[model samples]
Target chain A: MLTIENLHAQVEGKQILNGIDLDVKAGEVHAIMGPNGSGKSTLSSVIAGHQDYEVTKGNMLFQGEDLAKLSPEERAHKGIFLSFQYPVEIPGVSVTNFIKTSINASRKAKGMEDMTANLMLKKIREKSSLLEIDSRFLSRSLNEGFSGGEKKRNEIFQMAMLEPKLSILDETDSGLDIDALKIVANGVNKLRSNDNAIIVITHYQRLLEYIVPDFVHVIFDGKTVKSGTKDLAIELEEKGYDWIKEMV
Target chain B: MEFKEKLLDSHLAFEERIDLSDAIHQTRLESLKTFEQKGFPSRKDEAWKYTSLNAMVLKDYALFPQTETTIQLKKVKKYFLYEIDTYKVVFIDGVYSPFLSDTTHDGLDVCLMSAALSKAKYRSLIDTYFNKIINKEDSLTALNTAYAQEGAYVYIPKSVVAEKPIEIIHFSTGKEKALWLQPRNLIVVDQNAQVQILERHQSLKEHVVVTNSVTEIYAHQDAFVDYYKIQNDLSTASLIDNTYISQEKKSNVRVHTFSLGGKLTRNNLNFCLNGQHCHSTLKGVTLLEDQQHVDHYTLVDHASPKCESHQDYKGVFSEGSKGVFNGKIHVDQLAQKTNAFQQNNNILLDDKATVNTKPQLEIFADDVKCSHGCTVGQMDEDALFYMRSRGIPKKEAKALMTYAFANNVLESVELPILKKRINKLIAKKLGVNLGFDL
Candidate 1:
């Protein structure tokens, strides 16, 4: 359901993702494991249509459409979601309001009727409960003064609400404790379906142990050097990324 | 005639056209004479440096005559605060319309400024504080004080708390070439009393009208007063308003000014904390677009000990508009333990849009806490990207972030109805509706 053909992207004149090729089918979880500055987060951001990143070469196809030509909002409407490494704190915009706006906008784009406030509140409560997030967070400003774990949990909760066809978790394991990581992984796993795909981006194999990816790709220096089963993530975590770099 | 010559001729004609009767008119004539002596201020004047009245002086705009086109009272009935049962006063073309006003309250007294000046009980009070806060030496202020005709008078007795807010609506309506109306107001809250006042300035015509107004407020010892000014005129209109607030011992005062309309607008607000333990808050928000220019200059004076004051003013300028904010706070040596804070933040949405913010603090007391900051910037890029990434369009994202930027100032308003109205007006001005969820 997702394909990246030798994607090359640059941010501020510096090439970060140099020739990244990846493919993920529905009902499968793919983990992209890499060290810092390995272009792991850049890959997700470029696919999500971040304005700062320029695609110098290569093409991205999601559901058989050119993803590069689509704006970020259009990409979102097309059922592509990126769980940010660092969620932005939008002051004065309550979580409930922001999520409602997003949901309505997406629905409007798909020619669906607008969701009522009562129905939205009920759906948000259900999602919050499923994600183990506190319902009180719905009233507060989006991620404003929230703890790191709370921010990550909020991202997972958003993913659960949107239910995108392809969900990319970019470094969701960072800044999370073992318990929070397990909860976030469980939330992602519960939302998985036969028609949906998941791309779990992480630096360590700790999150992979809970999410259990079907395909584990070792990304070194912006390229996927090794592709194997979930055991590849465990082997890379034990030996570190240097061995992968030497092999590349 | 040449524009400058015509302007001078108009000034001379206005001087010769005065028909003075009472002491108030005589005092105003003296102010007019003072303005004649000073003439129109030039760019040489320090305060008039950034803003030039050269257009006003050199354009030879025609002065509007007294308008008899009666305003339909029902046209403005919807804008009044219906939730609060308060005294309502209406003015059209700077003249008080008694037919449109209701004065049935026992503890509150509201009347035309002309009538109030003739009364013996309020004569001295009006004469003492009318033009005291504004600098008579300043030419424009003197000119306003000179041409001042009709206004409102609100007086609350001592130890009596007003049950409802007082609403004053100033409307300008005429098809004349150019109209200049001066609306003056004096509000006196007696000791230990409490009151809230809302002054809304609007226009019904598309004429090039100028409404120069002044509102002076006196909060006596232990009194609490909330004052709000909303200006939403047409693009062909210009407004210059001076609001002076003086707080006595232990009094608490809050002033909110929202400027949403007019082609050119300037607001000068001065607050003096004259009594120990006095508290004051001055907040203003200006939303401008389409070459509109809005300027707000505020001065907070901490003259007594243990006084506290806070000022936060924010502006959003788009479509080649310009915004200016100059806030000054002064803490005297006797005002020890005084805490004062001033912040001015502005967002410029377009490349051609501009904002000039200057926050100044002059503190003589070593023991006071005073801080001032100013920020002129565009919308947050990360916030915009975050919103857009969530399937919200770019325009909607921008509007959302800009609304959030101005929400800090709107949230400071204590009244919910007024807050909702101002938010709607802001959204209308910004040309986007984020709905009531904000």
Candidate 2:
């Protein structure tokens, strides 16, 4: 579903992702485990076409098309979703309105008619119920005054609504409690299909227990230093990142 | 002659048309003398530092229309709030247009200022609330009072709620080569009465038209009044609006001013809390592009105990447009436990766009709670990117953010149709097609 070869990137002239190479097929979950400042978030941002990050070298291909030429919204139109670590607090736009706008915008870009109001509402209700979100929560301003757990759940709820082909969960477990972590992981598990892929970016292996990844890659400094099965996450959890730093 | 000198020279000709023996005529004579002494405010004046009337004062303008012109309802119907029923007091080229007006005097008096001034039955009301609240020291207000012959007059007696909202519209039909107009309005909401008024100034064609308007509102004890001013005129139009509001015990008064388009516009809004527990709210939203200019000067005077006031104004300027916001809050020595809050925020879309915001507070009461804030900034790039990443294009994203930034003010509008109209205006001014209604 997605391929990145030696993806070198930087922000504000400071190199962050020196060279990241990753590949994932449909129905596969890849976990990029790294400590703080390991460019995990930068890689996701680059994939989502964040204007702040400049790809210094290499290329990213989504469905055989280069992503560097696409804008953030264009990339989104091509079905790439990035769950932000810290969602912005837009005080006036309600969650329902925001999601409706997003859905219609993507649909418009694809030359499709806007989703009927009834269909949109039905989808919102279904997805929100899947994530255990209250109907009242969807009427409130987007992410404003939301608790840490609520924010993460809302991100997953947005993911459910978008139904993207490739989704990047960037540190989705950092701020969630165990119950919320289960809910988010379960939601992702339900959305997973043979036509889609998922990249789970995290610092701890605790999340791997919930939605086990097919391949676990250890990223340090910038590039991947080790790639193994899900057992690598358990080993790293027990040994800690200090051994991985020494190996680098 | 220059417009200022022409105004000073036209006073005698104006007085010849009105009754000289009336008591209001004497007030007009005094105001004309004051305007003659203070001519036009120069840039050196502290209050007029950022706005200069030099260019406008130099133009030659006809004080009155050369010939009366009639307009079909089809031509200017879109300017009215046609979504709902309203009592309209409309004027064309500073002259009252009875054909286009929907006035009533049944339960409440929703009529014209000229009738209230000339008729003997309304003499007492004309005497009591005519110039009671306006500041005599303001030269522009005094100039409007000197030529205060026409506008809207609304009176709700004690315990009576006006059945319908009043719409005061002034349309310039481009009958004269260049025109100068002064419209006067008086609204008296007696004790326990309630009223809502919407005022707008429009120019039908691309001709120079300047409207110097003054409105005085008196809210007695337990009265409620809502006033809205919509200034979206043609590029050749300019407006100077002076509105004075006086509130008594337990009264509530709110003024919302929307300045969307104009060559130059100035709003002088003042509120005086004369009794305890009065509430005053002043809000404004300004959007300008090109060389358009808008200035909002508001003052809230907390004179009695337990009074409260809130002032909020937002502005978006693009290109070479200029915006100015001056909010002043004053708490008298006896106004203990008074609460006052003022906030002004501006977004400059281009490097050349300019905004000057000033919050002036003078508190003499030791037990008062007063706070003020002012900010001028560009749109948040991070927020923009967040929206864009969600598949909303940059233009639509920017427009949505701007709408959200200005939406909070519209949320408080008591009239839903007016709110919807202003929302559409904001969206149109931003020039973007949103997926959903704003």
Candidate 1 docks with a DockQ of 0.74
Model 1, span A116-170: residue lDDT tens: 8788878898899988887788889899999889999999898888889999999
lDDT of 2 by residue, B51-89 (tens): 999999899998878677789999999999887899999
Worst 10 residues of 2 chain B by lDDT: B429-438
Native contacts retained per candidate?
0.66, 0.64
Which 10-residue span in candidate 1 chain B carries the lowest summed lDDT?
A: B2-11
Best by lDDT: 2
lDDT of 1 by residue, B64-182 (tens): 45555566657877678776676878877666677767654476777677677666776777777777777667666777677665678888889988887888887777656676667
Against the unseen true structure, what C-alpha lDDT does each candidate score? 0.82, 0.91
Task: Assess each model's interface with DockQ, reporting 2 decimals per model.
Answer: 0.74, 0.75
Model 1 segments more than 4 A misplaced? B1-21, B60-64, B82-86
Q: Write the per-residue lDDT of candidate 2 for residues A1-248, one digit (tens) a residue.
A: 79999989999999999889899899999999999999999999999999999999999999999999999999999999989899888878889999999999999999999999999999999999999999999999899999999999999999999999999999999889999999999999999999999999999998999988999998999998899999999999999999999998
